[model samples]
Target: MKTVILIGAQGHMGQAAMTGLKKHNVITASRSGTGCDHTVDITSKASIKALFEKVGPFDAVVNTVGYCEYANFSEMTDEQWDTTIQSKMVGQINLVNVGLNYINNGGSFTLISGILNVKPIPMAIADATTSGAIDTFVQCVAHELPRQIRINVVNPTVLEEAWDVYGEMMPGFQPVPGALVGKAFERSVDGFITGKVIFVDA
Candidate 1:
């Protein structure tokens, strides 16, 4: 089985991914610097570098971390924009860049985006922008990555477990189970396709 490094291993998506990736040798990480096998703050390049160093080589990297602000586009503050750009956009890419040397040849990188990029809501400016950026980034980077390292993103809809709080906010669209979304990440890690956005529709 392939060795996988899973960042953000304690979140909702991360826990779901862990279940799907159970067959593989999965290493879990969190930013709390406790409980998990490793700690990483994706927003900091230095922190990312250290995590990889401690962890060593791997066959795939799966990231289920990131957050975006929800607010009126007009009133969105600079801090909100920065938080999304720095953590969601830049942080995910940094994992690929800093992880190049640590991954085995033909290994894959699976980043998480959300369906918000396609079915945007009223206050999803930050989420939409960052999700869209990650899609473009993977498409662009896939062409130039050395060592045959693959990269892709999983765009999942609102999760079933989280529907209680978000159900009223998101109408019309059904919430997908996290396990169903985990299949997309499995495809990215185990399949040969790269630069594709695997959608988890509900």
Candidate 2:
């Protein structure tokens, strides 16, 4: 079976991917080291390099971590902006940069984004910006990556269960189940497409 790494292994999406990707050799990683075989600090190049060194070789890498700040562009704090840049954009980008040396040829990389990338919302500039960045990165890298390795991003609408917390902000959006989002991740990791943003719409 092909080997895959599920970053942020303890999150809901990560857990769901664990189930969906059970057929592969799945290795889980979390910053806090929860529900994972390894602990990875994606922001640190040394941490990522050490992780792949220990795991030997993987066929794919699925990143399910990263969060963005919510505030008006003017009111957004430097801390919030910096956090999103470091955690959401730069961190994942760094993963792709460093992970190039570890995964096997023809392997794939899967990333997560939300509907906010396309659907604009107040105070969601950070999220939407980062999500769009991810998609762009995947598209550009797909054409440049050596060895046929592919990359894709999944952009899901508001999840059904997450409605309880965010329904007011995302009006009119039909919610989707977490399992469906999981399936999208599975497709990105195992499918043949590259540089595509698979929408998991409701």
Candidate number with greatest TM-score:
1
Residue 50 in candidate 2, Cα distance off native in Å: 1.6
Candidate 1, after superposition: displacement of residue 145 in Å? 1.0
1-202: candidate 2 lDDT, tens digit per residue? 8899889888766876676687888888989887689999887889988898988989999998887899999999999988887878888888889999888999998988778979898999999998989888888888988899999988888777577888899878898887888888889887899999988886
Colliding residue pairs in candidate 1: none
Global fold similarity of model 2 (TM-score): 0.94
Task: List candidate 1 segments past 4 Å from native.
Answer: none
Ten-residue stretch with the least lDDT total in model 1: 14-23
Per-model C-alpha RMSD? 1.1, 1.4
Candidate 2 ranges beyond 4 A from true positions: none
Instruction: State the lDDT at 24 in candidate 1.
Output: 96
Query: Which of the numbered candidates is closest to the native, going by highest lDDT?
Result: 1
